[model samples]
Target: MKILVVDDEPDVKDLFEQRFRREVRNGEFELAFANSGEEAITYLSSRPSEVVLILSDINMPGMSGFELLRHIRTDFNAPPPPVVMMITAYGDPESQQQAAKLGANDFLTKPLDFTVLKEKLRTIA
Candidate 1:
């Protein structure tokens, strides 16, 4: 499976790599990174069909995750649209509800629980 991770934090790539080392080594999944929503959108536009999942941070310098979610839902509505999971540091109910309403497949709080994330990925796969 191919997954795209969108976050402004530079260390997120390393963290995800460390957390999913086994999966990466075993070729169970391929990971891609984008530092902002604009970057993520550009990447998706080029290869929308390649990614099966997107994990995006809600707060960023530009083009917040919610906007990205809306873009994906509006422009990429092809059958089996890529599954999107939104991550935010602020675990507010309103943001969670908005994300769901915007078409996020899952909403996750920051300081992620990788075990739960893995379970969700398993179900999707």
Candidate 2:
């Protein structure tokens, strides 16, 4: 699976790589990182069909993940992946509800448990 992870934090790429090392090595997953939502959009625009899933953080500088989700739901001419999971440090009910309303396939809170995330990814895969 080719997964795109969008976050503002610089270290996120390394974190995901470390957490999903075995899956990456075994060819079960291919991870891509975008430092911002704009970058993610650019990546997707060029290769819309490549990404199988998107894991995006809700809080970002220019384009919030919620906005990104909305864009993906509405703008893409090609059918992008239906699975977009929103991740955030804020796990409030309102946040969760908003994500669902915007068509998120799932919601995850930060300080992420990769074990649970891996299971979810497996189900999707």
Candidate 3:
């Protein structure tokens, strides 16, 4: 399971890599990263076969994760694995509903609880 993490924060990428490094099955899951939606799109376009999951932050500068999610579902058609999850500081009910309607598989709140996120991730993968 190759995973692409799209976020603006470098720490987020580092932390994720650190947390999951021990669990990954000898590179079965390679973690790639992109700082913005445009960069993520570029990576995806170039190596569509290398990505199996996406962990994206909902708020970003240019194209938000929601926008990215919409693009994937609408443009990528039936071939994509779907977004693994989205993280956001704003846990509004409306936002959650919108994410679901837009096809987000799951979500995590900001100040993320890694234990819970890991369990959820395990359940999926």
Candidate 4:
């Protein structure tokens, strides 16, 4: 599995690398990082068709995850990646519903619990 992680914080990317290092080491998964939604989209758009999942932060400078979700839904009219999960510190009901409406596969709260997230990914993977 290839998981494209989109977060503005460099530290968050480092933490994710730390957390998922074993998976990468074992060759079970590969991870990529994008600092913003636009960069994420650009990276994915130009990729060699290998991304299976997207883990995105909600609030971003250029494009929010909600808008990114909308963009994927609209732009990927045919076959698209089936897994796109939103991660946010601000997890309100309204935002959750909005994310769901925008076609997010899952919404995860910040200070993430990797155990649970892994279980969810198992279902998708």
Candidate 5:
């Protein structure tokens, strides 16, 4: 499985790499990083079918995750659209509601719990 993680923070790539190292080493999954929503959009445009899942931070500079979710739900026309999971620092009910309204498959709060995430991935896989 290929998972695209979108976040504005530069350290996120390293963090995810470290967290999912076992999966990567065993060829269970591949990880890709995009710094912002625009970058993610560009990546999706180029390889619409490659990514099976997207883990996106809700608060970003250029484009918010909600906007990205809207785009994923409305703009992307690829078959079997990638499952989207929204991550936010603030676990506010409004934000959760917005994410659900925008069609997110799941919602996660940072600092992400990889144990739970791994289980979620197992279910999806």
Candidate 6:
């Protein structure tokens, strides 16, 4: 499975790599990272169908993840749109509701729990 991880934090790539090392090494998953919403959008535009999942941070510098989610839902016309999982440090009810309204596949809290994330991915895969 191919997943695009969008976050402004530079260390996120390393963290995810460490946490999912086995899966990555075994070729069960492939991950790509984007530092901002604009970068993520650019990647998506170029490789619309290459990614199966997107894990995005809600509070980004340029374009917010919510806005990106809206654009994805609007622009990506594939029959089975890529699953978007919104991640936020705030974890507020309003954000969660908004993400659901905007068509996010899942909502995750920051300081992420890899075990839970793995379980969720298991269901998706």
Quantify all predictions' global Cα lDDT against the true fold.
0.93, 0.91, 0.80, 0.84, 0.93, 0.93
Give per-residue CA lDDT, model 1, range 50-74, as digits (tens): 8999999999998999999999899
Task: Mark the 10 consecutive residues where model 3 has the least summed lDDT.
Answer: 75-84
**How would you encode candidate 2's per-residue C-alpha lDDT over 9-77 as one tens digit per residue?**
999999999999999999999999999888988998988778889999999999999999998887653
CA RMSD per model (angstroms): 0.8, 1.2, 1.8, 1.4, 0.8, 0.8
lDDT, candidate 3, at 121: 64
lDDT string, candidate 3, 5-104, tens digits = 8899879888988888876656646788999988888888888656767888889999998998888777654565555578789988888888888888
TM-score of each: 0.97, 0.95, 0.88, 0.92, 0.97, 0.97
Off-target runs (Cα >4 Å) in candidate 5 are: none
Lowest lDDT block of 10, candidate 6: 72-81
User: CA lDDT of 120 in candidate 5?
Assistant: 99
lDDT of 6 by residue, 30-93 (tens): 9999999999989999997888899999999989999999988998748678999999999999
Q: Return the TM-score for candidate 3, rounded to 2 decimals.
A: 0.88
Choose 3 or 6, whichever is better by TM-score.
6
Model 5 Cα lDDT, one tens digit per residue, 1-125: 99999999999999999999999999998999999999999999888788999999999998999999999888774788889999999999999999998899999999999999999997887
lDDT score at residue 86, model 6, on the 0-100 scale: 100
lDDT string, candidate 4, 1-125, tens digits: 88889998889888888888887898877889999989887887787357888899999888988887887777643475447899999989999999998888889999899989878776777
**Where does model 6 exceed 4 Å of error?**
none
Off by over 4 Å in 4: none
